[model samples]
Target: MADLAHGKPGAGAALSGGHGAASRRDFLTIAGNAIAAVGAACVAWPFIDSMNPSADVLAAGAPVDIDLSHVQPGQQIVVLWRSRPIFIVNRTPDLLKTLQDTKDISLLSDPDSDVLQQPGYAKNWNRSIQPQYLVLVGICTHLGCIPSFMPQANSVSPGWLGGYFCPCHGSRYDLSGRVYSGVPAPYNLPVPPYRFVSKTVIRIGENPPDGGDFSLDSIEQI
Candidate 1:
């Protein structure tokens, strides 16, 4: 496969980060409410470097560990990391195959993840460290709108293969988070710096074991 950042001939975009302490309490509350509005529970974050993630910690780009033991295939859970929605999808075998098919990926704008939208380890056909799990920033590349998870086949349109649908502007991304060609969204969904801590645990806001010096800020868009 061609390199998204190097082999691609065009210039790619740059990815788009603070906080305080009473001030710290207020920030956490706001962060908690932001998550609540999205229907996600604010669980205590256990980062590899820190036992507990305070509002100040998350605001400062600390990692967040999420338990995926209960997340079944085809189910996705949203977790807040660095105050942004991180989408974790437990992909089924069928979805994995779809992401690898040449015909399917040909319809995407950046099938090879050549735009540096993801970490070095996640620049694959699946756009993830593991083929069965997909981690991405829930915000759309265009206008930063949160894209709705549309996993069911044909749920958004006739013959839809299943993925995310940005209701805000009709931008569509395949299950692998690759944007469809000709869409208003200029690039694929930004994949955060993440690593699988265990079989059923993921640590977001951190680099993968083999991913050296890769940061989310290096992505083409966020």
Candidate 2:
């Protein structure tokens, strides 16, 4: 009877050992699946980040488009390209007359436009494809402060003529954005590289190869 009891106890021990081995194998399989899922998420993160816009967009020198349909006459709008502000102005008939009337020629530092200031197509008296549209950089050439637009008629203070006024140093520009002879700024505000993609759309920052440099010199010659 004692020999029979020892044999039954040994059989029970063998069954428990088999069950433990199966449980350990199942645990390892679940752990491996969790690790694989984590690895997949890590790989996907970089692709998601690449889809976002970066500083490279500014460095690439891409052109920006402005819609003129809503741009009111005598008002100006500002847009950014390559970290620079490009100002677009819709001139009233009076503003156009002011540009035409300022004919001293000698008063303008680059009156003949010898310097490369704007694109070729923008060299006209108004500095744009349409007489009412005017595009220029907002930063003052003297010290890089943004000039304030004083568009109201006779807004020019005291002896100053009507135009943009730089509060930093009291520099004055005419309605056509030509700097006064005695101002701190040596040159007129630069006209950025731009083109008219449509009647209502102006593209800034890049000039078309077929269109040429569009610099101030080119426009003056036209």
The superposed Cα distance between candidate 2 and the true structure at residue 50, in angstroms, equals 21
List model 1 lDDT by residue over 1-222, tens digit each. Answer: 222443455533221002322344455667888878665332423333366666776577778889988899899999887778999999999887777767767788888888988888888889898888899999999999999999888899887888989999999999989999988999999988888899888888788667887877677778
Tens digits of per-residue lDDT for model 2, 97-156: 766654544566665445556666666676666778888888887898888988775676
Estimate every model's Cα lDDT from 0 to 1: 0.82, 0.71
TM-score of predicted structure 2 = 0.65
Superposed model 1: Cα runs more than 4 Å off: 1-60
| Per-model TM values vs. the true structure | 0.72, 0.65
* Model 2 residue 68 lDDT score: 85
Clashing pairs in 2: 118-214, 118-215, 118-216, 119-214, 119-215, 120-214, 120-215, 123-219
